[model samples]
Target chain A: MSEPTRGPKGRVEIKSEECKGCGTCVELCPQDVLLLGNDLNRMGYRAVTYKGDGCTGCGICFYACPEPGALSVYKIKDKALA
Target chain B: MARDTFTKAECLYDRYVRKTKVEPDQVSTHYCPGCGHGNVHKFVAETIDEMGLQDRTIFISPVGCSVFGYYYFHLSNVQAAHGRAPAVATALKRAHPNSIVISYQGDGDLAGIGGNEMLHAANRGEPVTMIFINNAIYGMTGGQMAPTTLLGMKTATTPAGRTARNEGGPIRVVELLSKLDGPVYLERVALTDAKQIYRARAAVRKAIQNQVENRGFSLVEILAPCPTGWKMDPVDARHWIEETMMQVFPLGVTCDRTKEIAPSEAKPVPFVHTDLRALLDIEDESEGFAPNRTHSEGVERGVRLKVAGFGGQGILLLGQGLAECGMGDGYEVSWLPSYGPEMRGGTAHCHVRISERPIGSPLVAESDVLIAMNRPSLERFLPDLVPGGTVLYDSSLIPDGVARSDVRAVAIPATQIANELGSPRTANMVMAGAFARATELFTVDHLKASLPRFVKAKATLAVNETAIDRGAAHMEKLLETVMT
Candidate 1:
């Protein structure tokens, strides 16, 4: 059984249902953090999967996705604030 | 459970599909994959949202790729005719003085076909913001040659590649518009990369801020990508804009006068009944003559008259006098003038409608009366005269007889009589007098009352007054002879 996991800086999360499987984000990722999955969504297109580590939260994938909500990078702030 | 971090764009609609669309399940736009319009639309929406102008904003979407702005913006939107966004935005801003209006246009829509409209609007300092997307080609029309097409760029229209010897050089719009004194802010920006996109977002916000602050005309020219039109991939198109288009259209704030120009505080024009009445100088019916009472003799319809002559022949003044006198007599009146481009010796005509009730249109398609001040005018307007209409022509100038047998015609030597009264310029006034006498629609006293109001010079007014009298006497003598 797989459990929810976190990466060092942040992880790239893809809305698998909304992805068009264009592979633009996979091709553009400098750290090789994303790849087109073998499985297809209900729309009959392959969804992108994260490589589970090495994401820098650069936001390049978010900008490159034609679909606005297809991808987002979430990071936890280091210092605690009031 | 990947922690619900990935989310939709803050500016985008909940669903990508327009609410008014018939296909409810559709959640996408008709724009090509990775089209720059989607990015630009997001920027505009974010600006409107951040500035709290969503409720008061009006987006004028022009023809071209940006015509569907209403489908996405989720604000008040109006679709303008091709290349007419600036003109439409100018009127919308003026009409709703408090609302923030934006003109969204593309290269072909703005610079190529709507150049004059954009130029005049900016020159006049219209208080509106404009978003110009320059993608170097006409994207909506299958990539036609645009005014901003690169020198060697090949488009649908320029199949052999744009050449300086034929297609001329691309236009630099931001720099060109910066020369104008009206615009308060002008900037050229790009969406090439994340850094450039951030800068473009600032420019977009500044442009909308200018309108919200009522500063004056503001424009942000955005160098956007058109991958499909450019025959390149989305990533390559972004690179092309940075590498190629940047060489032609440099990105920067071309002009910024926001600090110098103060915000406008003018109030919106009032459309209340009392205000309109005072503005138009419409007298109360009870305080003046009840003109429709005279038509108890059953003159059921309105009197539509067409007056035509050369530009300097007082044709418009003659029509104005009729409309003014009709208004004085408590009748609803309208006067519309048409003239040629030449200032003098140009063809001039006016339609005057005097109605007991409200006038439907100022245009007289089938005139009940035709006043031809010259031979050319008589021939020109003869076809528009209705059967049984009255034809009054200047006998001194027109040598031909009336051609229509069904109408009552009278040829008055109006110019000759005015010359005897010491001025040939009062011929139109003389004709006005003949109109009063022959039709008895308005009395000679009404004509006398309206004449003094229009003619400023004392001597000229006195001569015109005498000409009116003599002209009326001539028409009456003709009527008497016909009766005997």
Candidate 2:
């Protein structure tokens, strides 16, 4: 209800539940922005998410992630995934 | 399209993340050991990495030893059906014209069943880069005789040498496809040694760059080796590509439309118009359309014919022109160029299998009908005619020249009829007429309708109609006594 219009750069959302924790995307990430998530899911595989000030709005992670829609990278010149 | 974040700078293969110089962690290649496909994949990936197009490029991988290419390309890729990579590439290139679309396929994938897709895509000049691997056999299917199999090369089905009487010869794909006017750049390269591998990689980059610049259809057919399928060691495989494959599928550029493509004066890569239905359309008449053609049984529903004659005698057109007629008559039909180089002023032939059932095995060991435009073809193929099959030839060819006795042989004055029609080129149409009249292979009305599909000029179409009718009229009496 509080959300306003999102314009310009596209929104990228990470579907946390679908993550397979293959770590391929993590290893592939040239930015060193994604570290394995500290929170463990019921499946026991460590999930991956953006760390502090590390993500630099790179889309290569989107393609490198084989899991469909699990890891989406949004466009924000200022809001970094880190 | 919404803009997305990230580029190759974030990928694992980027120098910083690679840890070592080796990128794309060495996973066990899904391809068999020593297959050139692995090396080819490496070249493509390395080229894309060097070009910095990894995020923007899309790949279409065909079913073969290379089907698992998505694992290695480090880009968005969709695996395509066997022999269908060209078609898929055509579609993706049109829909996403800015993306660098590429198709990687084996010889059997590009030159056999997928041949139509390959030709149509190239003829239309799609801005897609194609990496054709000419390995001479259907590697994924366990070494079957592919359209690219060289004459005298043995395979699972052709354990004996592919002879003119049966398997014909290996198809020269680059040379054959180069004739299409729309292709802007065509090059046949190979990977026999270190220098050749370097050249092959450069060829890959060039083809990709051509697509990126919107020049036109660009293809680099790599004379790749299949050591497992060829029953050779890796070293010997390289030797074969140098010795045998190069003899037939010579390396270097065959046709390059790049002379006029100076990027300083060029437009962005143009989008290709590929009609899906047109690619798969079956010509047919409204009246004979069977609702349950799937299970219908009339006249046992089709015949397979092989026609052989010299290149200038209208040999190939005869089969294609008739196949068009049969297709118009609501019959399922496929016409394939006989496996071989198109002999210069020498023998040329085609295979036509018209059936309600789907066609299989373009190879013809026993044809329902054989039409020979000369004495040599008759002598060569007469022995393989099916029992009770019809063998028609030019009356000009005499009995001492023939080689078999089990089947029926009818000598029609095909050349005389064609010459009398005022066009020696009509000899091919004359044979088509004889075939149609003899077997009701398809109706003449339908055959005429199919004629214009092959010709863009209406005047030529009108002339061919006359020639075909004349051939049919000339052979009527003889056909009545010898055929159904």
Candidate 3:
């Protein structure tokens, strides 16, 4: 995965620190963009990580997260990348 | 993306109060894993914050796990009895029209115990929002069978899978609400998946928006997950809501008249005091009688008299006469009557309070004077008489058992006097006459003038007047003999 310093409006961010390893976002994400990482956070639960590069930022993952501030999406201006 | 890059929702409170007493440090939430209450709470709080309704919100939490809802939301929350959330919310909204009232209830509390309250509130088109969380079974009470429990579903109470023949059928709350004409918006949403969550959030927002616009009753039934009660994993619980619960309670907008129906003119009714002069049309007689210095100067408090007898003995009427006579003399008075189910032959009693100042309550537990017309009445009320209190009874009926050292228990031949007057019912008037002379509270003339309102028969009026005179004369002779 290409790591971007500044998340463009089209990208989505998952706060792996607060993720409960529920995998609800992974199963419900339409773009297949997220996956559970091998690493565990301070809460001792496996956190979700971004994988695919087609960043549409649909906000499905943001709404599905049970934990507060676990996911956030930024709308991208470029249509081609979405 | 990064770990710390996510932004918090603007509507969620910064911190939640710890609910459980044992875990004082557990500040996150009391909800079990996969429970939809946490999600719903976030959505509701966010909606209130977004709408700028934090100060105006009053949530009525029903008896369930969400009873601690006030601790979480940090708003003016009231805990209603089981199934009475809608009723409480209705009153709250009616009392304070500017406030936004929300009734949050669960399956068992709402559909099972509070079905009538919910139905009636919606039927009346009460301007309140309801967030109904239907998780199929009773989550708070270890998976008991709820009104919304699905067929063939196993719960703690229904160990052998729920049968339609035995457990009836699940209630479709959204469908039921949609059938009512008062509801402005009704929708059933679920928290099963991402797409479903989006729809649920929208539905909740719409329901609250309806209340804000004052558009009558709005209900949003949420198909929530209960993993512990369902005995399933969190993922499976979410899946079950989508697969099983949806089949029974379909996820959709059952009613939507937001645009068509205008906001109701349900303003709070201002209290208009009734003018006593116009309501009763009685002349102000307070200026006629001079205030008694003994009572008005606090040297004497007042008389708390209790009158007891058989129901047919006109005990209630005697007490009313005493109150009316005191009122006619420009004194504050109150009369309260009590009788059993068998109105005619049952035990009857009345409390009459007369004072220079306004009386507080009409219940006389410890009476200063007690007039008992029968043996049972004398036995029942003699102990409640205050020490040094005077008791008057009918010597003709109560032959004996007038033993008391502290109080003066006098017996008058009231029945014999009424028999002489050719009416058995005039016994109470005889007692009333003796009561007036013994207490020195009123004269026989004042007592007679108060009779027109209480006495119905004009023919018996002459006999009753003669009986009152005889009763007073008998008491006066007894007092003279005692003094000698």
Docking quality of model 1: it rates as acceptable
The best candidate in terms of TM-score: 1
TM-score of model 1 relative to the true fold? 0.82
Residue-level lDDT of model 1, residues B210-233, one tens digit each, is 887788889999998888899987
Model 1 is docked with a DockQ of: 0.27
Off by over 4 Å in 3: A1-62, A65-82, B1-13, B18-25, B264-266, B275-340, B348-373, B390-397, B412-484
* Chain A: TM-score in each model: 0.82, 0.68, 0.79
Residue range B147-243, candidate 3, lDDT tens digits: 9999999899899988999989999998998888888889999998777897898888889988998888999999998888998877888998888
Q: Write the per-residue lDDT of candidate 2 for residues B198-269, one digit (tens) a residue.
A: 678778888988876778899888887787899986557777888888888878887887768765322344
lDDT score for residue B435 of model 3: 83
Q: Look at candidate 1 and tell me the lDDT of residue B4.
A: 25
In angstroms and one decimal each, the interface RMSD of every candidate reads 3.8, 11.8, 4.5
What are the root-mean-square deviations of the candidates from the true structure over C-alphas? 5.1, 15.7, 5.2
Supply the DockQ value of model 2.
Answer: 0.08
